[model samples]
Target chain A: MTDTYFVAVDWGTSGFRLWVIGRDGTVLDSTTAPLGMSRLKRNDFDRVLEESLDKLGIAQDVPAIICGMAGAAQGWCEAPYLCAPTRLDALGEGAVSVRGATRNVHILPGVKQMAPANVMRGEETQIAGLLHAEPSFAGTVCLPGTHTKWVQVKDGAIQHFETCMTGEQFAFFSQTSVLSHSMILDGWSDNAFRSAVRLATQDPVAVPRRLFSIRADMLVRDQDSATARATLSGLLIGQELMSVVHYWRDQSVTLIGAPPLCEIYLMALDVLGVGGRSLDVETTTLAGLAAAFHIQTGTVHA
Target chain B: MTDTYFVAVDWGTSGFRLWVIGRDGTVLDSTTAPLGMSRLKRNDFDRVLEESLDKLGIAQDVPAIICGMAGAAQGWCEAPYLCAPTRLDALGEGAVSVRGATRNVHILPGVKQMAPANVMRGEETQIAGLLHAEPSFAGTVCLPGTHTKWVQVKDGAIQHFETCMTGEQFAFFSQTSVLSHSMILDGWSDNAFRSAVRLATQDPVAVPRRLFSIRADMLVRDQDSATARATLSGLLIGQELMSVVHYWRDQSVTLIGAPPLCEIYLMALDVLGVGGRSLDVETTTLAGLAAAFHIQTGTVHA
Candidate 1:
């Protein structure tokens, strides 16, 4: 009962995850619910938070630190974006307090890039986590998702970043476009993925053309569904790499996301002769929230 | 009744266009039905054909010439794809006969490219139409649509051709992807479209990056949906042009498709300083069908 020191929450758009941390930064206990920000209104947020804390058997007085879409405009309480060139350590300073909650609760801020116009809700904390682990870390970070993010970090702040719709684009074409009619939804091929990435790296701008080739291969050349599916993934990721290949090709790269998706990115980077490594999102998010919790609520334990 | 020389039908995936031609290759009557190949089972095709012919008040003895998806493997009767370098004039030579029908019905063959694997069901007829108008027409033609096609025509044969799923890709991203949430479905911006096309041509592989910008622009830059929609179109078309720009850069390109779609292609082509002209798809389809009727079933009138 005394092991729990603080509560950490990663409340995303579709999923909610909470962890009870000890005084020395260990996970004492954890729980998860499908109650993401998307499922709750302003009024329901307090109830969900209280229920989550109670379900974990944590003391009501234990302060909570939250990140992700829970800080979005449509979330519990908008933690307005902290514009980029934002110091990773200073994220705690921008945390917005939940109104009328029994315990002290803070939602971390997102970062918005004004030029080229991009935004990230939960990733800023992950960036903080990276810095917490390697305060001197300097390089580019790639986060793969439906809207994949490519961020540049140097010194102690997020200097710049760009978002690519490659993942979503791949999904739409594979599942909803005319190409869907010619594909086997469950089949895949690694060779096809590698070959496509190589082709995309060579002609970068021609990925869209190769997309039609996927359909044509089935219609004319007897290419199987396995090859088609992999080729689709490779073409999209390859196209994305081309935009930043010049910058990332010569630098050390860190990919932080789910391992399966990150592996594909690493494989693609290898095709371009670029080097990179990955960190799991769960570790980073927890580290990030803990950092913010300590900075903003240092007296909670005292 | 005397003006009815032969019946010509353009049966597509979702559209059925029929034209009744005169002895001198003028349209005597025409009709269209919503019953395209996609909406019917194989057994329903002959009935649709009979009903369509009867609806047009044409005698069964008049005979009928058909093109497009009606010749697809899934359509009425499979008129197998005529592998490429097959003479466009020989499209009629490859037509397959339908058995036990009241009239002598023939379905024209589509063109298929083996390497890079591509096939076209209806555009070959449009190419035949181009040759009928200018038998010596030698250059490239761009037909933009759900599956936009680029063909290299020389000496009345489709020397080589490539299909770009650009239109469909744009539609999916604009309407189905995460970007759709930030866009205005009905608004448009010419400048936005032109600039997007120009930028895409400048950095062909980066269109996916620009897609995220459309959403970010709305969220962070206060950009309107009008610009967002046009940029989406331009980015896709621009990427498509990048694939064929070198071969097409110095040639006299012809844009053949529905006027609205062709205009977008022509506008995109102009951005690259590539000089090209357009031909109405309807005009070309009719001319091609009449030529096929005269060559494949000349005895119908005799």
Candidate 2:
């Protein structure tokens, strides 16, 4: 039997993922549940963690490292934010320990920027993993999600970052706004997307008006549902790109997220003549948690 | 009892307002209901109109003039759009007559712009009313609502117009988005609103980022809900202003809308250092509908 060294948990607002990692730096076992921080009360966190460990047959002796909204003020334990410019490797120092827990439990802190007033949880761990994988990485790192982050890193630290509600806007608009009547979920049109991207990027201020055009297109020209969805997505991504083009204009961006979203970003970047590469979200998150664990146990140099 | 010469109906997507106008151009009596064009099926439109007329004891001999969603493709009858560079007074010529009804009914057509693709139903009539009230009125006319319109009018005709989804965005965001957590309905902060308007107008591309700042402001600095609401309103209106600044940059604009919405636009224009005046939505809508009725019956001169 492989010896389980520690448990890595990425406890987000609406998701819970746990991994039993062996001493050999490999995942021995894993489990995922919908018991995210949002679903658990403060007292339920310990019981929920214990239940998951019991189901996975992990011994109580195995220490656990947690990140994401579990460290939010309303989560298991409050892990306050570390203000930028923050060193990626020093994230472990800000970890808050869960009181009265049988096994060692450490929740990672988020990163906050004061000037532009930005806050990022969970994604910081992914950034840490990104830094560990490419030790000398610099330039921009984009983590696209409900609240997408465009982070600028330099010399192993996050210099600054900006957050855009692009994903959230897309979800809300496609589900609740008038655009819902025109958007379809299953198909996509690359040409429609590129055209929208070009239009939005060329005239960012025209965003509000352009958004209405999707409906007009449907009314006047009988636009298809798939093309409408792609156009909507492109319009949003293009507007976001316009806002952050200065951060990654000539530099190659490191996109860390789920494949479908990252693919969209890559396409949009291609249209803008910007270069970028993609990395899986889970791998980066696990690597980041492992790095923090190593720092916590004083076993490895960052 | 005073004579009710013609019925004027401003039938929107979710609201129905009717006014019985005398030959003297005075409103004899009026009633409002929730039976908007959207609420009634195609077959139910005539029945609903007849019922409302019956409730008001209106004579069957009276002709009716209808505007807004009642003329949409999915409404009682499709009143096709009149392409831009259209004369306001000529709107009566574009009115589509509804068949199989005892009384004569005319549904006014909306205006459509091809280049940047925008459509306006009901508001065009309001523009006509503005033109009727102020014959030499030129420059820009703004009708702010669920879909706000910025019209470029010259010589009593709509040269071109752009629609911004600012009001719809405000309603959706304040009620459903994450920003809802930070918003309050009752109080408002003029200072916070002005500051946000200034920021968004100066950097319109930063609209998305600025929106997230509302949440960050609440999270980091304990921002008040009223301030958050004001800031959100300011940000959206400011973005719209940025998009249509060319229409009213140095000109004194005529604003037509409900007082609350118009007042906000007025404040936003003031922040942008643009001149503008406000008119009541109902008054303008009635005037427009009356003008359409006159055109259909050839009763009044433009």
Best by lDDT: 2
* Candidate 2, CAPRI quality class derived from DockQ: medium
lDDT of 2 at A171: 88
Model 1 over residues A1-302: C-alpha lDDT tens digits? 45678889999888889999988788888899999886889788778888888877778888889999888878888899989888987888888898888888999999999987889988889889989999999889999988888999988999999998777777787887777876855787788899999988888866666788888888887778788888989988888898876458788689899898999999988887788999989899898998888788654412
Worst 10 residues of 1 chain B by lDDT: B293-302
* Per-candidate local distance difference test: 0.85, 0.88
Candidate 2: tens digits of C-alpha lDDT, residues B194-286:
999999999999898788888888888888998999999999988888888788877988899889888888898998788889998788888
Error of 2 at A85 (Å): 1.0
- The DockQ values of the predictions, listed in order, are 0.74, 0.68
lDDT of 1 by residue, B1-302 (tens): 45677788999999899888777677888899999998999888888888888887888888788999988888888999989887888887788898876788999999888887889999999999999899999999899899988999888899988888877777777777767877755788888889998998887766767778888888887788888888889888888888877558888689889898888887888888888899989999988887776678544322
- Deviation in angstroms for A168 in model 1? 0.6
In terms of lDDT, the poorest run of 10 residues in model 2 chain B is B293-302
Name the TM-score of chain A in model 2: 0.97
Question: Which pairs of residues collide in model 1?
Answer: none
